[model samples]
Target: MGCNPLHALYLGAFLPRPPPPLPPPGGKQDRARAIEAAVMAHWRAVRDWSPSRRMIRLASPDQEQEEEKKRDLPRNVVVEAVQHLLEWGRQRDQVRGEKHRRNEEGLRPPPSSPQSPSGGSSSCPKAPCSEASQPASNSQPSSGETSEILNQESVNSSPAELDSGVSEHTNISSKEKTPSGLSNPHSQKSEITVNERFLKDYNNIECIADGGFGCVYKAHHLLDSTQYAIKKVKWAIGKEEKVTHEVEALAKLSHENIVRYYTCWTGKDIFPSEDSDSSSGEEKLHKCLFIKLELCKLTLEDWIYSEESTKNYKDDAFEKFQEILKGVAYIHEKHFIHRDLKPANIFISFQNIIKIGDFGLVTTGADDIPVKRTRKKGTKSYMAPEQVGQEYGNKVDIFPLGLIWFEMLHRFKTKSEKSKRWEDVRDGRFPPEFIKAFPTEKSIIKKLLSKEPSKRPPAAAILRMLLVHLFRSSSI
Candidate 1:
C-alpha cells in the first residue's frame, strides 16, 4: 500500500533522518537488499543537515516535495518521541546510580578498615568540604592534593556533558575508518612503547601531571624546538564523537588569554601496550590521542606561594586577574562552563600573562535550565556550594575564580596562615588592611563567591565594573 507523508518534511529530518525511498527496480533478492542499502547510504551523507543545506543539495525544488510524500508521521510527534527516549535514558541511569550507591553504603565495614565509627559519611566520596552548611575544617589540604584526591573522576570521557552548536560525529574523512587509541588500563603507569616516528615528533618530554585519563607532558617540538604541553589519553572508541566534539569546541576558542590549542591526532598503535598475557597482540595495538597545546612557565598554584603576593604586587595581580577574566568571559560567551576551574588549571606564561588551560571538565554554559549533574565533577575544596550533585550554573566557575582572586590579592606568608584564613576569606570576611585598600574588589569577590549562582554577576558584567573602578582610580 502507498501512503502519503504528513506535511512536515523539513523538521522530520532534524531529530532523525527519515526513511529512504523504496529500492530501485531489481528482480534478484540480493540485488534488492543492495539497492536498499545504497539508498540508506545516500541519506546518511545528508543526515542532520539544516533545511538550507538540504535545499541547496537538491537539483530540483520538487525533490524534497516528493521526499515529503513518503513520511506519514507528524514532525512534532517525532521530536516528542526523541525527547521521551532521552528522558527515559536519564532516569534509567539515575536508577542504576542509586542502586550502586545503596550497595556500597550497605557493605559492612571490615575490621581495621578506616570507615568512620559513626557510620556517617557525606554523599560525595572523599569530599573534604562537600556540605555547604557545615563549617570548613582547619585541616584542609592544598589545591594540588585535592586534585590528586579527585583524580578518579578524571578518567570519565563523558560525565553528564551537555554542549550545543557542535557536531559530535564530525567526519574526519582520512582518519574516520582507521583504528585509534589504547585499551582502558593503559593509564595505570604502565610501560609505554611509543613508536619511533612518534618520538621523532617531539624532544625532551617531561611528565608535568598525571590523572586517571593519563599524563600531561611538557615537550619540545622537534621541528622548531618550541615548547608545548601534550596531553595523552586512550582514544575512547565508543565515545570518539564526544571526544572529538570536545576538541572541536575548544579549538574554536581563539583568545590570547586562553591557552592555545594547536592540534589533536590519533596515534594508531604508536603507543604499543606492555601487558602481554591479558589480551591478544592485535588488541594491544589500539590507538591513543595526543593533544598538543601551548606550554607556559608555571601555574597560578606556584604563583600563589611566591613572595610577590605579600604587599607591592596587589595592583599587578588585579591587572593580571582582569586578563584571566577576559579569557573566562570568552569561554562563557562560547557556552562552555569550566566545571573544574582552579588555580592549577590557570597557567602563567613566561611573559607573566595568565592563560586558562585544562578544558578536561567543561559542561554546558550560560543555560537557564537547572538539571542534575555528575556528583564527582570538581576538586572538593574549591567546588561551589551547589556543585555537590545539585543543579548549578555558570556561577560555579565564578566561585572558584573568587577563591583564586582572593589568593592572588591576599598576603599569605605561610601554609598555616592560608589554612587559618581560608574559611573566613571564603565567607567574605576581609582583613582590615585588605578592606581599606581594595574595598571595591573585595565587594566584587564577595559577590562572585555568593551562595546563590544567580547572585553572582556574569564575567562580562564584572569586567565592565573592573574598568569603571580603574577609570575612577586613575582620575583620583
Candidate 2:
C-alpha cells in the first residue's frame, strides 16, 4: 500500500535541502565546480526516487534516446545565446568609449608651454610635437605660449610643413607687430598671418572701392613695382561655402578677356580691441578671405560717361564693343553664363583691353538647356524679358549686349534719353534716329533685343558678325 500522505510530508521535511547556490562562478575552476554540483544533485534525486520494476521495463531504448536529445538541445542553445549577448555588449561599450574619447579631445584646452624665469612662456625651440606627443592635459598653455610654439616650429621646419600644421588650428596667434592706419575700430588687428609671402610681396594697401560683398584695395608688388587689386571679404559665418565656390569658379577660368586670378588668403584676426586702456587679452576672432586680382584703370561705365571721353571715338568704341563680344563668346564656350553683364562689371585695362569681371552672378550648364531661376538678378535695365519672369537660356546675355551697344552709339546726352532708351528697348522699339545712323548696327540690335529668347543670336554668332564689321571698317 502507498505510504500515508502525513508520513511522506514528515519524511520530506527531514531530508537534506540542496546546498545554497554556489557563489556565482568566479573563474573557470569555480564554474566547473558549480556545474558538477548541479549534475550530482540531479543524479542523486533520480537515484533516491527508485521506480517499480514494471516502470523500468516499460522505458524503451527509443524513449531514453529522446530524453538525451532534449537535454542536449537546451544546453547548446543557452550557451550560444549567452555568448552572442556578451559579444553585443562588448561592441556597444567600445563604441561608447570611442565617442567619449573624441568629446574629451575636443573640450581639452590647447597645450601650454612652461613659463620661463623671465615671466614669459619658454619656446619649444625644437619640433612642435616634442611636448605635444607627451600629452595635452599635462600642460595648460596660454594663447601667447601656443603662438610662440608655432613661431619656433615655423622657423625650424619647411614652409609647407608650417602651413599644414598652422592651418589646422583656427586659433593661431597673429605675428604682425606693426599697426596699420586703416584698421577698423570694430575689428582688432591680430598679427596672425596667412601666406606671409603675399604680405611680403605686396604693400601700401589703399582702399579703392567698396561693394556689397567686400572692399577692394590697391596694392603694389615689391619685386616688379606692379599694381594689383586685392579684394578683402569679411567672412560671414554661413557664407563660407559661397565664397569658396566663387574662388573655385575664378580659379578654373583662364582667358584674356576674363579678369586674371591671383592667389587667395584666408585667416583669422582679433576684432579691434574694445578696451583702449587695458593691456592685451584674449579677443574674439574674425575670419577673412583675401582675393588678389589684376588691376584695371577703369570700368566701362567710367569710360563711357567721363567728360574727357566726349570726342568722336566711334571706331575706338566699336573696337571696345568687339572686345566685349569676344569675352562674352569665350565665356559661353566654356559652358558658363555671365548673368550680370553690365557696364560696371566690364573692366578696361590701361592697354584698353576689355575683360569681364565680377563673376559672382555666373552660372554653368549645357548651352542648349535653359537654367530656371525664380529670383531676378542682374541690373533691371539690362535684364532680358525672359530673365524678368521666365526660365532663360544663354541668350539672356544678348539683351544686355544690345543695351550696352545702344549706350555706346547714342552716348545718351541726358538722363531722360537714357530712361527713354530703356523704355524703347523694353518695348522692342529701335529709335528711328539710331536706325538711320547705323542701319547694320540697328539690325544687330533688333535681333539682340528680340522679346523671344529663341529669336536672339548666340554670343558666338554675334562675335562673328562684329568681326566682319571690324574688317569692313578697317579696310575702308
Q: Give per-model TM-scores.
A: 0.54, 0.54
Per-residue lDDT of model 1, residues 164-186, tens digit only: 11111111121112122111222
Candidate 2 lDDT tens digits, 326-436: 888888888777788888899998877898898766777568477676558777888887787657778878889988887887777787878866787666677778778
The TM-score that candidate 1 achieves is 0.54
lDDT (CA) per prediction: 0.63, 0.64
At residue 333, candidate 2 shows an lDDT of: 82
RMSD of candidate 2 to the truth, in angstroms, is 22.6
Pairs clashing in candidate 1? 5-71, 180-287, 181-286, 181-287, 181-288, 182-287
Best by lDDT: 2
TM-score for model 2? 0.54
